[model samples]
Target: MDCETGFCKNDVQCGGAGGRPPASLAEFTLGGYGDQDYYDVSLVDGYNRQVTIEPIEGTFRSTGGKYDCKKAGECHSNLLLSCPEPLRHLNSQGHTVGCNSACTKFNTDQYCCRGDYKTPETCKSSTWPVNYPKYFKDNCPTSYSYAYDDEKSTFFCRGSNGRISPDYRVTFC
Candidate 1:
């Protein structure tokens, strides 16, 4: 199948090479952080498709009234249709194929959360020329829209000590 991102040079797997940019990602750190699996659908690299990471059969905890384990993604939203003109990734046919994050499109310190803005305190999206991260967050509420979207987008589940490991269902749309 043809793909704008994550093409893998016609191979089924990317091997050691990373997928192309503007590809949605379901990131995971299994059995991490207090023996809980951490997972998220990150749009920080940009968004080529709708993605969801759902954990199956795990003990979920609540921290400060927020559930640690739950579904994370933008399964219902087709970001290509709503992508800003400056961040729109187009196919050969000139159709909108993906939506790039401000960092991917601009490559500036401010948008990328690097250089002087390397720290979260200095890299606030509200300080940008245009609040581009807000655009992604507004559309994909559950996904990581920017570099420091941990509070809203990161999820965790406990599956340790002979407990059944949670199977993740990653759905791409």
Candidate 2:
């Protein structure tokens, strides 16, 4: 559990994804982003599984702030249920794998926030497909539903030693 550099490019397990439940509940990397251990409840690429990063001792705990990842009102809007007809991604057993971003699903420059639309202003969320982003946002408000969600999406973590992390947990619901 010692990663001295940032998320290794080839490490598929860094996010605790791709594994079955419980075993994948705690996603950790000894190496971290920059000098700080940064993590996110990221859904920018799309998701079907519902996961949450409940901070044990961080700003998410200290401030009691909800930030972008707020509790939603409805089951469908809040939990990402019954994914849109076109956006569904099913595995061989017919269970949903993950949601695909507009960019992944459609390959459009605007949806991707690529090409001339790389900036936040240029890639306004208001212009993208409605329910898809809404589903992701409502389900995991703190995560990045789109490209420009970086500033608010990432959460910084550190242990008592004060040098980022050696252990972290990302829980799945």
Candidate 3:
């Protein structure tokens, strides 16, 4: 797999190091708080490609009927094709390689959700001068488009008897 981002210089594995920004990410925390497996497909760093995470088997619940332990991220849409011009990441060949987040492209407090926009209450993507996250969310509904997309983006699965966590299948394109 030759990744446009996360390409480990001539190596197959990253060896614990993280990939660069402008790449789709499958984030996971196994045996997290409350013995649950938390997972999400994040585009907060930007989107180089589409990615998905599917839970194999587990005791799933929607707590308050809010979240579900289902598939996350995009399996179809190609964000690069629809990337905004200002947020488009170009390669040496002048081709669009990735779709960068407004925060990554502009580096503003409002877009980055930092400074005064640090809190969830203040960091509403809808309030931005240009809602860039909306582009990602509208295309890939299950992905984490920005920093505070937790209510819709975060997903978790628990064991049947607190003994087995669900295995996940992460696919990238």
Candidate 4:
């Protein structure tokens, strides 16, 4: 019934008496960057699988970074924030498609808008529909917002008008 840091116990034998050694544990060390911190984690498994997790943190350094908004709608006017690199072509559902090259630059008036585009019309017609969720459209609508919740290991989004919305979820990649 014993387990390590990132692993749980699995009993393959009868009565869970004599099983394998407790699974290897993973530990993390973090380094600070401005107001952000990056992490390095050591992972071990019973199969001798050892892995390292690094570069686990991110933040906007640009003074005019529009993506740094505290709420979704607030990100609309800043030209510095655009679709995340992996999310450009994808829609709110996270499906991938080719997006407009001009989309590389932030456009509050465009289909992808700041956080999420308003109507499904704004989303479905652009790359957002294929890759993102409908909630993104409903919540974000105009601008993009960002917030960090350390307890949940999560980042939340909001709209230009400072309305909180569900945008993207971040996990180990």
**Who wins the TM-score comparison?**
1
Best first by lDDT, ranked: 3, 1, 2, 4
Model 1 residue runs over 4 Å out of place are 58-65
| lDDT (tens digit, per residue) of candidate 3 on 1-173 | 66666566667877887676687889998889887888999999999888999876655444543445788896346888989899988887899998889988899999999999999999999999999999999999999999999988998877564455766788876
Candidate 1 residues 1-173, lDDT tens each?
76787677888698977577788888999878677788899999899889998766444443533446678885456788989999999989999988888999999999999999998899999989999989888888888989988888888876534663477788987
TM-score per candidate, chains pooled: 0.89, 0.62, 0.86, 0.17
Q: What is the C-alpha lDDT of each candidate?
A: 0.82, 0.52, 0.84, 0.26
Error of 1 at 57 (Å): 3.7
Off by over 4 Å in 4: 1-7, 10-24, 28-34, 43-47, 56-173
| Model 2 quality (TM-score) | 0.62
Error of model 4, residue 53, in angstroms: 1.3
TM-score of 4: 0.17
Q: For candidate 1, what is the lDDT?
A: 0.82
**How many steric overlaps are in each model, in order?**
0, 6, 0, 28
Model 3 clash count equals: 0
| Residue pairs with backbone atoms closer than 3 Å in model 2 (clashes) | 3-30, 3-31, 47-99, 68-141, 69-141, 69-142
TM-score-superior candidate, 3 or 4: 3
Winner on lDDT between 1 and 3 is 3
- Tell me the tens digit of each residue's lDDT in model 4 across 25-107: 12222223333322211111111122222221233222333323222221122111333353334335664322122223233
Identify the candidate with maximal lDDT. 3
For model 3, which pairs clash? none
